[model samples]
Target: MKARTDTKEKIMELGTDLVESIGYPSLSYQQISSQLGIKNAAVHYHFPSKESLGLEILNTAIGSFEKMISNISSLGLWEQLDTFFKSYRKHLESNNKICLIGASASDYQELPESMQAAASEYLVLVKGWFVELLREGREEGVFHFKGEPKHKAAVIVSALAGGLQHARLVGNLHYDEIVEQLVEDLKP
Candidate 1:
């Protein structure tokens, strides 16, 4: 929309990175502008408010995660689980950033009403995917867990989220242990 023609995209890219790397509440137009070497008005021009930016990030994250889950839908059960675990691990390489789900969730109370709704939608989509995956995997004898799929899925998701946060304070070993034990515990 400007001479750069990708300023809006760049803003969104940096915006989300900041949200995941730092917390969403820590994100600021000034911080974004400083990182992108643009003026604060440049960010403001595209996103009139922080809520607008947060909403856009959540929407984009939902679409991205939907696509990711679908892409791995054809894989073997264990492979699919490995891919899912890898997604969370990828963030550990980048300033101890957690997944967007965890980042947005930590700020849920501070989010605007619309942002909160989007966050809830994101949660449902992810947890639903995990629940279905666990159900199918167990039915196929790929997993040997002893709880309702929904309950187990919630525990897995929450542990991974918390593991990422804990990784930042301690080290990645704690995160790796969580992933390993999760898979081990689900073994046949």
Candidate 2:
């Protein structure tokens, strides 16, 4: 029983790394199996399909983001925003990979319906988190943005996600400048 659980986890972990480094469309049970020294049939037994594994990866990322959001409630408005920026930077710097949803979005039309829905849900989750944070920041007089919190949230999320991609290509120093300017512009 423990061995079964361990194998499943190994598949999930390596699947996620592959998807993040490459992309969902390029991932395969064969690749995972080769990396883990397991037969491709073993991966099939656990995941059944690529879409199933992709969905699980999306859910795991979403769950982790949700926990991060929950923990930020105790932080100051500026601190919360800064923390978000730093987290995004950390993700890119550590792995040189874009956020899973962002990477999946590039091949969104090619993805299975279930995987597409999971990616959409992940975007909505991040946008919703930003909306709440922006609204709180406004109420607290820490944010001086001129638009609706929802709109502002969309811009911020887009900028960070897009910026990560740009940074991946150009270099982290340039990305840092752009992000620093973004955070600066949001100040009251």
Candidate 3:
């Protein structure tokens, strides 16, 4: 049972990387199976279908987002904002900035219904978290953006998502500059 669970997790992790880099249409059971040193039948045993595997990958992303939110619960407003910003930087610096959600969102029409719904849910949740963070940060004078918190949140989310793609092309230093500009722009 433990081995089965471990193999399932390995599939999800590798599947996530494949999907993030190549998008859903390019991901396949054979790729995951070959990469993980397993048979396609084993992959199918766990996921049963490509749609199931795609849904699992999205669900994994949702779980990671939830964990990120929970991990920052004790932080003050400024620190929380810093942590949020740093999450993207961490990914960039690690050279893992290619985002599964970004790829999923881009390939939305190609996805199964379950995967589409899950991807949408992840975006909505992330945007909602940013809205709350920006709202509270403004109330406490931690952020100085002029506009509705929801609007700023949307802008930030879109910028970071777009910035992630741009970084993959223009390089990390440029990406860091964009993030620094965002931080400076929000200063009171």
Candidate 4:
């Protein structure tokens, strides 16, 4: 049982890496099996289909982001925003990859219905977190932006996702500068 769990986890981890490095449509069971030195049948035994693997990957990424947000929930508004930017920078600098949902979105139409729904849910989860944070920041006089918190949250989320893709081309330093400007603009 432990071995089976480990194999399943290995598949998910490598699958995620492949999807992030490339894209979901390009990830193959053969690639995962080759990387893990396992038969393709083993991969099939665990995932059975690409849709299943994609759904699991989306869920794992979403859960991970939720945990990160929860962990920083008690921090001051400014600190929470700082940590959020830093979290994105961490991924950008380390992997040069956009968020899983962002990457999946490029191939959204090609993905299975379940995977598409999972990706949509992931975006909602992140956007909802940002809305709450922006509202809190506004109430605390820490954020000064023109529209409703919901609209502002959407802009922030879109900017970060766009910035990550841009960063992959122009470099993380440029991305940092963009985020810094965003933070400054948010200041009350």
Tens digits of per-residue lDDT, candidate 4, 89-155, equal 7768557988786787888988989999999999999999989888888887889998998998888
By lDDT, the better pick of 1 and 3 is: 1
Question: How many clashing pairs per prediction, in order?
Answer: 0, 0, 0, 0
**Residue runs of model 3 more than 4 Å from their true location after superposition:** 93-97
Tell me the tens digit of each residue's lDDT in model 2 across 87-186: 8887576667787867888879888999899999999999998898889888979887888999998888887778777877888776688788778778
Give a tens-digit lDDT track for model 3, residues 1-188.
99999999999888877887778999999999999999999999999999999998888888888998899968987787788778766666645446766888789899989888998999899999989988888898888998999999888888887787888898877767777887887889
If scored against the real structure, what TM-score would every candidate get?
0.95, 0.94, 0.94, 0.95
Clashing pairs in 3: none
Candidate whose lDDT is highest:
1
lDDT of 3: 0.84
Lowest summed lDDT across 10 adjacent residues in model 1 is found at 1-10
The C-alpha stretches of model 1 lying farther than 4 A from their native spots are: 1-5
